[model samples]
Target: MAGEQTGVGIADPALEAAAAPLLDKLVADGVAGKLAAQDPTLWGSDAEAEASIRLSWTTLHKSSRPLIGEIEALRTQLRSEGIDRVVLAGMGGSSLAPEVIAATEGVALTVLDTTDPGQVADALAGDLQRTVVVVSSKSGTTVETDSHRRIFAAAFREAGIDPARRLVVVTDPGSPLAELGEAEGYRKVFLADPHVGGRYSALTAFGLVPAGLAGADVARLLDQAALVADAIAADSADNPALRLAAALGAAHADGAEKVVLADTGSGIAGLGDWAEQLIAESTGKQGTGLLPVVVENKDAPGFADAGSDATPVAIGPATGAAKIAVAGPLGAQFLLWETAVAVAGRLLGINPFDQPDVEAAKKAARSLLDNPDALRGTAEPSAVIGAVEVYASAGTTGEGTLADVLREFLATAPEGGYLAVQAYLDRLDDASASLLRSELAPRAGVQTTFGWGPRFLHSTGQYHKGGHPNGIFLQLTGAADDDLDVPDRPYSLGTLQLAQALGDGQVLAEHGRPVLRLHLTDRAAGLAELMRAVQELAR
Candidate 1:
């Protein structure tokens, strides 16, 4: 097995050294022990482990290579068959990875990640007669994926396309998806190894995106990932992922409350979401651990240019602070951030994995589907009903003091409900409109809104950019002095430049949006601020 190895020359001795205490703490706290025991196969002989990891990673990369060939093939096939847009259908890990690949390679791809009827409706709005449907699911039983499969399959019949000619299935060999493909006589079928989880499968059949669309240098990508696997397998604590786990444990022990994972681009954004699930599912438990908080770069015109005038700028201050540390893979700084979040969760005595709340929300949503009228109520039954008066505080103070005030305010407010706007009067047109439209909008009382994940800014970008700009923007910002160098650009220089060009700070300032800026020298302070803000908002 390939053990962890460091990349040649690119290895950071200082980083390894700095992470020593954290690694030691992780080993001491039983986290290292748990992982070691859970997956000893991964830590076996370095060569073997490296080979295994590389095989999987490279497979994904290699899959894309054949994709270029496949693309030419697809183009010819499509041209002869008179097919136009290709619809790739999947959700979560299956869709996110491919979506990233397509976005990065500039392949125009449409993804179906949600079960919302409207989204599905839009995806099928095009010329189904000339469209090819690609249905992907590692498990093959994912309710949403299967639901979409049924929907598309029906649509295929409705459009008069032979199901055999237009449908493609990508899944594990013995999985239901594969079975369905065979039974339905789909023309193309791709199989992923069942051993790989949805997130990890990206490098396998799950990542055969380039092949599916006929774009990208899959071979080179595979080689690079294989090299990374080799390096990781050979190294010890110096291994980026392992070192990250160690850092997370240490930060948690240091009283950090949450892990803030961030990235600069869509590729990294998807990866961050994957990391969130990994940590949340793997380690989140026992009531005393750091929570994972994922952050993404906001979208704006001139976002690609780090130094462009219209780029968004990072506020000098860190807002929405938390105490838990952040870390991710070293090769990719974004990965480093993710790993840091895991490490911080461990240190904080919280599981970095597992999201019970998500399940609860899903359950609630499912129940709502059974009784559509149940959604009519704007407020929870227990919610207190009343009119609210707005008040604004001018002075800013430390978290401890602010938290106390917030707690007092919450206690004094009528138990029924109250909306606490940070400012007495700020543009709230956005919220008001949303309340009138969005099904999930809060009633008269309290609602929490903020931009965290980077991708959401894309969907909501228009509203934030050119729209009425009526929302209360509780902008959260953070900075770490320890910067990584970008492979193509000067590390986060692109990110920094984009931030400035968007005039992100100016957006809030000029719009007169209520803004709260928290400054922190490190991850811990940032998390603290975030928690305080959340609490204040809740209050």
Candidate 2:
């Protein structure tokens, strides 16, 4: 059961049986060339509805193979030009893959996925002459990536450097970003295949260009991905991706809504982040989705115990684990989850390719940018202690105290409900988030989720607003010691972050969600306040 025959080491008799019929239908429908005609049912929609079903397979094509050589050539050229650091300016699908590769391979690549002014400054801290910035977005119109390009391009010009020499673009063909890149004299423009969605673009230029620029063996990564694609084509129980998909579908059917991922090896450190965006944005809709909670350390006290509706999956170097490699395992995982989530979508009766709710917050943030006065009206603090401010966004009509408000909200959590703790701070680590979950889980009597500002707005925020009304939301944000203005925009990075936070709150409030807002003087104080609040509630 633990041998290579299991492929990625997923072995379960019940799940295999449950998946047999669906697997057979898929195979007979011409998946992996098992039959003549194609099967649109595999993606839970017709060909007209879900057009990007097999676009992921393009990465394995002979035609796409040549791009590996091109990426290698570009890598060599950048090295020759003495570029030491490569900063990836993007978000969600565009940034997650490169972040994982850079972390796994120990490359000098930094992903700026946040609007925190401190983060913007930190990403551009090094010498402009020695750095190359890769601006990536599948839509070519993501506000965060565009803001990054403008700010950094301004910084580059102010330093007496040619912004074009230090800039490259990765986006879909004919996207506005592509035209802008060409007009601005970009060093190179790698257009991704238009059919590939952002979450599925890891194998496209969106991911490879950054990974290659950061010195990863792009060829090897693709080689590993091809192997997984072959396994999926086999469409057998032994196929790792199929087996994993069956497991996920079966688990979901059995009422395991919380999918807890434990990523131990540094090889796939950022895999959870990538998978979070994919799983949340894809499967989360119509009042259902997989709530993926990535626990950095499973042995950390409270996480070892899961609620009744939780599924614990471990991905690391142990025997029967996903089996870590320098880069192969991560690539294998990128394909594995992509296939599994699609299959899971079929099981859940939802379209896995579309994200309808992700645009609401984007639209709201833009409206704030257009009319800054519309950002007026702060909710009176329900409670302010020390440098922390707390405002209940939902279910505030019957509150006695801030603690009582939290207690009342937690008390009303429906069976199989979850708590989402959103922290809008400069810190990116999940230690505090995870720690707060440790305290809140037993007290709230439900599973807990922790996400930083704006980033989660693009990912799980969809589920919180559109999916089941079972999420109890708590948002925490803080002031920064230093704030940098967005180049050519009326607001600073800090203000944009707050606007995005408030915009999301407005949307969630409009949807009748139970949300509580908290503002702290700074991140350190914010995290401490969150810890104290959880500890008090735990009592």
Candidate 3:
């Protein structure tokens, strides 16, 4: 490995020190140069096929230049028609990158990535005549995006606007969505690079179309990424990408595998959330991967509660306590982290390009959607505390006050284990439900991760089942006040949402992971009771 340092953008003394040995070895082996050259052999033979195609994202800064003009033209056409609102329907990276790009650029892009009826209804309730929906899916078969497409088509038609005029589709070249959009006579059909995987597609159409159409300077993002392309690709001791890779690789190697992440007052709004999926789904397989614990802020309970063994990494500026810090423009950060994670995969002895376990939950959800009672949650709750119905997967969480039961459930977290909080509720209306992460983090005394349902199933859901088996799960689902239908599907949004939660829970239980499932019989009352219990436990 080469010695000395020059351009460590993700810099911190402790992290650099911890990463030095691995960074040296990576540099000595010419990993950076090989990865920059798109050498599939870098991640081993098993991952070569995926790595070959996926590496195209590295050149998108130049290859995607043509898209900027097309996107700008579409935006102009939409504006001419008095359509200013842009709603994006996608999942995981397809939705996250665009959301982050638009947010960082101070552009407004409504993102619909959930199966909650209330959330879907909220997205559809806006001015339909003045809104254009960008439906994006890599597979062209994502249930959530397809459902959003159908609902938008129906909503536009009801408003006397031709569906083809207001609905745009983005997908891989020959994907079902591409065909559907073409056949349906949509306003525009953007074919993303088939080589780009959904999670690593920040520089592709998956990240640009919705963002550009929503008014973010998608071209400027490419320019920002270009600024750091050389820095990331260089096989030097100071390569920022290798710096991050070393920190993650060495930390995982040293057994401090849990990565506790914060925004660090960085101008970036949702980078942690976006990077969470990248790290989790990319490396969280083969029974080992870095678990990203994203806290809301420095004040979040996770900062105080996550055990001392966790690796402290910040997104924007380095905080005093951070061992590693990644600071850059949102666009540059995207390319840097994607490259870093790919390199980290080599260090971790895993195939970064393949998500081998993501389909388990999907299959389970499909079974439940097909049979409805395959998992059987229709039975009476194991116990009721206020409006919360508790369903313990295995051992009891102590039948007492909700707070007492919560304390027992949290106490069950194994040594060095983490807590996964999966909430299947309307994120918009029940945004406060997210506070459970902060509240329960201190109580659980473990790195606590919170994810909205169906979406997380596409993100950390992979890690929960595929990575190390040392995690306890907390699932929260609510009774939708009023549910919406899926246009032609047999199931309603509420049913599909619940099925997704239950399906995931079943898989977790099957994997021998402890699960505490709570059903909110009433959204408002149940959340109130849940907070009351969590606060009491904290006290």
lDDT of 2 by residue, 25-105 (tens): 555544443311234445543433564444543344333577788887877888898876889998888888888877777
Q: Please report, as a residue range, the 10-residue window in candidate 1 with the lowest summed lDDT.
A: 308-317
For candidate 1, lDDT tens digit of each residue in 357-402? Answer: 3333234434544443543332221111111111222232212343
Ranking, TM-score, top scorer first: 3, 2, 1
Tens-digit lDDT string for candidate 3 (1-539): 01112133444455567789899999999998888788989988888887888888888898999999999999998899899999999999889999888888888999999999999999898988789999999999999889888888888888888999898999999889999899989999999888878899999999999989988888878887888899888889878899889988877877887888887766877888899999999999999998999888765665534455577777766665667777777778888899999999999999998888889889988999999766454657879877899887688644888887788888888888999999999889989888888888877777889999989988898899999889999999998889998889988888889889988988998999999989999988999999988889754
Error of 1 at 386 (Å): 15
TM-score of 2: 0.90
Choose 2 or 3, whichever is better by TM-score.
3
User: Could you tally the backbone clashes for each prediction?
Assistant: 88, 0, 1
Lowest lDDT sum, 10 consecutive residues, model 2, at: 318-327
Where is model 3 more than 4 Å wrong at Cα? Answer: 1-15, 304-306, 375-377
Query: For each candidate, what is the lDDT?
Result: 0.42, 0.72, 0.86
